[model samples]
Target: MLLRLPTSVSEARECLAEGAVPIGGATLLWAEWQRDGFPALAMSLRGVPEAGVLGRDALGAAVVLHRIDDRVPDVLRLAAASVGTGAVRRTATVGGNLVGSTLRCLLPAALVLEARASVLGPDGVRETDLSEVTAKRPLLLGLRWREPVASAYRKLSAAPGGRPPLTVSVALHADTAGPRRLRVAVRDGYEVIDGGAPHDGDPDTALHTLRQTALRDLPEAAWDAVAAQVAVVLRAADDV
Candidate 1:
């Protein structure tokens, strides 16, 4: 495979517009590509000077992942759970995991935190919410997020190998002009959050369903209790 390392975001954009597949850290892509060849041209973004920095934005309310920095602890924890094993964690790029259509717990966490993306595309530099960009596009340049009121991620796996989680849930608590914003996302099959609607039910009902759906391996009643416990903790945190 041929690789090109662009030093700046503009260079990366130019290459992408010319039909080059942008790769960050190359952890996820390499695994899938090695098993099944993809036709697109490849570029390794690892050498780019800006590929690895994590910084807070001017307001100091959010976290931004630049191209040059290693994945943050929270991000690593999320990725480690997804693929399992230390080897995958080392190679998987936060950007790569987001690019995949599969529902990752972190994406919603970023959304709950009010994260945005700074994308350098052929048209020019554009900023959009990370959730919106990931849903609409196949690629991502970077991710940014504002300070979250509260956030939590939970996943359920059936076997010991830590295989892909059977179900995952992420909750973000934010204060809005209206009611306190409680955004909950559940990943099951290709559908995330049962048609992508935010939970509008009572906290008990919402938590019950989330846990039951996410932890298929566990008994419904048991998981429901667990879900209730999580909801209580999250709600309490939000209150504080």
Candidate 2:
């Protein structure tokens, strides 16, 4: 595998056009290469000048890039927390998570945070919602989003030596305008719950509603008792 580090999005796009897969941390690609030995032309953004800073655009909205400082609101902080351990977190670029769809792999939280990708593709730089970007082929440069009214992420895992999280979920409070605003995301193929009738009673109830939705969506045979346990923790956290 060859590595090319481009400093700018235009340069990265040119590289991608030439058949290079733009890489940030190369976490998933490296894992695949180690396991399967797949042949791929790799372009890493490690040495790229702007690969690590999280700065806002001209409009001064919160922009959460890997290279930037990490002093944002709950949404960005939670997303940053999903990027593996301390070392991996520091080196792993936001672009990597966006491109690899690892953001989807982490689940529930990203969706609830209302994350969106700022993509640089064949046409040029464009903004896209996270759900749409995950479904397409655009190269992800970074993620941006305003803080949610209320949001939380929870994961369920087995014993210490057991498997990783079997399920993950993110829930966010949306405006009363439409169903378009209410959002939930889950991993492990769990069923989803969409909470209608915005209630200001407690964020915990909202989260529980989403968890119940996921539980209801689970396949009869695949339902895990631990999911309910995690939901309990989320509910408790909401109370605090």
Candidate 3:
């Protein structure tokens, strides 16, 4: 495999134009590599100083997962803590978590947190919502988000080391009626948005009520188990 390390966003963009797959923290890609092997020409951002900050409102695409802490945001801390082990978290990057999340991945963490993507393409830079830009595979310079009034996250893994089948992230903001800015993203891209709740933490309650509603729609024992786990994640998001 051919390897090239880009030192800046311009060089990274040039490499992208040359058909080189950009590599951030390769925790996700490396997993696929173990299964399918390496690509032809890989442009690594290992030396890129431009994408290395874990800023309060914007995290550089190359920001290491483990670099985030309580000083950042509780919602983000909750999501980062739910990833694999310490070793994997140490090598994972913000962009990798968003782009390489693939299907049923943990990217809903970013989506529900109301983060924005700073995308770099051949044309120029564009600012877009996380949901809109994730599918395009843009060269991500960083992610941005403002303080949401309040936010929380929860994950329900099948077993000790299993992939979390259910993850619930919620961000709410104060308004005249109550918590007006409500956002949610779950498994399979199941999304919710609104002033659905009248106060803080009510989104979690609304999600828990979904179990009863789901119970009426299905008769299977497995769906019941799923609903139960959904309750667990949402409740955890509230309490944690």
Candidate 4:
């Protein structure tokens, strides 16, 4: 097996240009590799910087879960908390959590936060939306985004204790004059954009509409319960 460790972002990008499959944390990737013989070329991203919670929080993808808990916003914190246990978090990286996408709890939170990520490939370093990266990837060097006024993440597990979570996240953009940006990201990425707040035009109307627009496909029996839970997510943000 060919292995490369690039410490800097530029070096990481160079490795990708050569067709190396980038490995972030590899909590899952490594497992797959072990199961199906290792790949020809594997680039380890651990050498890059991926921790910090100040200013936009540089959050290098290599930073572990414990650091994520220390620096990221509440929504991200909650998502990180749900990843595994303290031991797992100590080894898990944000990029790893993100790659899990629906398999983990952080993707929805990252979307709700409208986080921005830097993907490096042969072309160059380009800034892309969080949701956009969810569908594609090359290498995630860093993630940056401003902290929201208030944000929350929720999960509906398949059972009492489960590894994968049916996750949902809500983020409120605090702007008094302009239309509110109420970002919500479900497990499969049901997103609701800008809308009036409970006070602006109608009380809970936007929230209710969000529930409808995002959860319209649910069966009649589960609709109300899901909506109620979504309401709790919205209310939780407002209560903060």
Whole-model lDDT per candidate:
0.51, 0.51, 0.63, 0.64
Ranking by lDDT: 4, 3, 2, 1
The sequence of per-residue lDDT tens digits that candidate 2 reaches over residues 72-191 is 444345545655577776655555555464434433445555556666778877887765665674666555566555444445554765444444433435455743233445455333
Better of 1 and 2 by TM-score: 1
lDDT (tens digit, per residue) of candidate 1 on 91-136 = 5566666665365545644554456776566786677775566677
For each of the candidates, the C-alpha root-mean-square deviation to the true structure, in angstroms, is 6.0, 5.9, 5.3, 3.9
Top candidate, metric lDDT = 4
> In candidate 1, residue 178 scores what lDDT?
38
- List, residue by residue over 52-121, the lDDT tens digit for candidate 4: 2233345676677776654566777777788767887887777777755346456767766667898776
Residues 5-26, candidate 3: write the lDDT tens digits.
Answer: 8887788888888889878777
User: Model 3: how large is the Cα RMSD against the reference?
Assistant: 5.3
Distance from true position, residue 101, model 4, in Å? 5.1
Off by over 4 Å in 1: 31-41, 47-51, 55-82, 101-105, 130-132, 159-164, 176-178, 194-226, 229-240
- TM-score, predicted candidate 1 vs. hidden true structure: 0.66
